[model samples]
Target chain A: MKGLLLKDFLMIKGNVRSVLLFLVVFCLIALEGNDFLLFVPALISFMMFMTTFSYDEYNKWDPYAITLAVKRKEIVFAKYLGSFILLFFSLIITFLVALGIGIYNQNFDLQKTFTLLLGCGASILFLQDIVYPLFIKFGVEKGRIGLFVGIFLLSFLLGWILKNVSISIPQDIYSFVVSYLPWILAVFLLILTIGSYEISKKIYTKKEF
Target chain B: MKKILEVKKLKKSYGDFVLGPVDGSFPGGVIVGLIGENGAGKTTFIKSLLKILQAEGEIQFFSNKKEDIGVVLDNSFFPEILTAEDIHKIMKNIYKNWDSSLFFSYLEKFSLPKNKAIKNLSKGMRKKLEIVTALSHHPKFLILDEPTSGLDPVVRKEVLDLFLDFIQDEDHTILLSTHITSDLEHIADYILFLDKGKVVLEETRDVIMDTYGILKCGKDEFSKISKEDVWRYSESRYGYEILVKDRDKIKKKYPNMIVDKITLEDLMVFVVKGRIL
Candidate 1:
């Protein structure tokens, strides 16, 4: 299991262009002050995760990889675990950078820094929850189209709800929502991850290969 | 003595091509050659064994676990960005008995650069790497599909010798599928020839060689042989070359006719032609 994880990590390392792209994007986000920097880790981690799926598709490696003793569930779980691991590391690195910038700008809000990480992580996890199953079922080629469309619809729905419902929540309540949002998202993602894994496993298990 | 692999009533169809429950079994301790023409479903059958195709069939190994089966497909298993070392790490975790020491030894023997990315290696080198990996696992059954398609004779011989050495254990069996029939003439114990979607012939190499013969005779003498035993018949200016399964019977009946030795390639040609000899 550790060997498989190491292989995935090395695969990510070997693909220089994708890693370089993440680094470039991270450096660019650093110039936007501390607020944007908070999302850097999530963005980079998601980028790495998304690219792995694409790489697998482009190379047609999944059919061969799954043939090994590694179950389809493990493949699916590994992706989720790997993504989160990368996400966590990226979050730590970006938070430190954001802190440095916050100090430089004299707007060092540790609370906001924590909130941003929490919010970004939650949103990305939800996206991961949704995208993982899509990739597993439809594969990377056509599945990606659905991913884009789904994300678009999700963003649109969120925008509409925010625009129409202007409930005047107190600041304390808003802070409460922000603090618990990750937990709520994490719980939802956990359920979705397990559900998605089962569905993917069923699809993969019955798959002819 | 036991069946190592059994594919029963396996059925797969493309728009035009179809392979049937290619009922066949690989018993332990022999090299089986799956011979077929282009698009004759040789690779398809092999892929089905490895479950590469989403086809309907039941494929079971003699052992409860499939880890004992090592598959070396025609193409590179890993992507170009990966080096041999990376594959070793991945395979070590996947196979229960992955011998890293043996794998490295093969790498050294094959002179494959351990650090070079697979994408940078030539086709032969990449294939060699896959074979090295396949062998190092100590799999009891080695399933090779078109492993020696376009290589020079020298490399093909080397690979064949490697396979010969692999089956030294009585428990080891090899299922090699190839279009190059001549390459398998010496090593293959049993032959399974596929044509179109169906199996044309499956028999021991010696039985096929000893039983089948090409009889050269005039058009008049050809009518004397039974059509059931005649596989294929070709004509020329002077006479006809007929491939007969019961060569001795045909010879005894037509003593005057010239009975020549037949090769596996000849049998394949005649069988695929679907003609009476």
Candidate 2:
């Protein structure tokens, strides 16, 4: 598993110039008070993680990797581990940049910034939980198309719900839910990520080279 | 002799193609040549043994640990963007016994640039790199699928020499699948021929070359030969050619007939194209 992680990092290292360029560009844009500051880094990190799958598919590496003295589940776990590490680093870097920009503009609200970063992190995790299993089952190319369609449908459903449904909540109940929202979201994301990992492992173990 | 690999009733099927029910116990310290035409299940058999594909059967390895086996597949490898140096680093972690010095020595001997990505290297160079990577771990068993396909004659000979050197310990074994039968004639101790997923013939090089013969005779002359001795026969404008199992016996019985030694290529052609008795 360590070897697999090293390979993914080395492959990502090949594109270091582009990654740095993107980070600098996004930082400059965020300094202009763009609301997309958190989203940009999160999306960039996810895309970087997806490129590893593309490289693996292009090289047909899985069959050869299977011949190595490693378990099938380890291979799946390694990908998930790589994603978490990438997201962790991205979260830290994005938070620092947001903090610097906020301080420079004289409106550095630590609580607001922390909450926004947490939401961005959770969104990225949710995207991974949904797409990793698709990639495992249908491969990167087909899975990418599937992801686009899934996102479109999900947005359409959300839009329909917002326009058609209205729920009245008491002021006390709304305040309680908002106060505990982060913890609730964290627990939900954890369960979903675990379920996704198990599903991906099952797909991989039964897969023929 | 100790068996390095044993397979019993191993089988895989997809669509219209089915790969085995293959049974064989390959001995250590010998190079076994697997020969067949296109779509003859050579790759499937190799993949099954490696567990790269799901198959139903019993497979036992004397070493028991996958770390002791090395593999060089024809179509799959590291991403083309990675350099040879990267492969060394990655493999060092993957294989517990990977020898970096030996790997670099092979790269130097092959004149492969450690910094160059795989896409920049020529096909032959890429093949040499794969072979060296497989050998660097000092594995007891090597499973090679067309490891010599794109190589020049000189490089092929050099790689063949490496295989010879590897098996000197008498605990190492190699199973090589190739279209180049001539290479097998030079280094292979035994030949396992597959035709349409079935093992048509398996024998030692000496026995195959010395005992199997092609008898050239006219129709009238061929009629006198025993049908039981002939494996297959083909007729041409000039005469009829028959493949016989015991050449010496046929030669002794028909002193006037011409019975010539058979090569692996000739044997494959006869078995695949010749009419059955």
CAPRI quality band, candidate 1: acceptable
Chain A TM-scores for all candidates read 0.79, 0.94
Candidate 1's displacement at residue A88, Å, is: 1.8
| Stretches of candidate 1 exceeding 4 Å from the true structure | A15-34, A154-179, B14-17, B54-57, B236-239
lDDT of 2 by residue, A26-88 (tens): 888888888676678778889899999999999999999988878899999999999999998
Q: Candidate 2: where is the Cα deviation over 4 Å?
A: A164-173
Q: Candidate 1, residues B1-277: lDDT per residue as tens digits? A: 8778887888889888899868888898899999988899987887777776777878778986667877777653766678999998888887889999999998998789998998898888888887888787788889888888666788889889998988888899999998888877889999998889898788999888788899898878777766775677887899788887777887888889888888878888877774553
- For model 1, how many clashes? 4
lDDT of 2 by residue, B1-277 (tens): 9999999999989888888889999999999999999999999999999888888999999977889999999889998889999999998988899999999999999999999999999999999999999999989999999999999999999999999999898999999999999999999999999999989998999999989999999989988988897899988999989899999999999999999999999999999999877
Q: Given candidate 2, what's the lDDT at residue B248?
A: 95
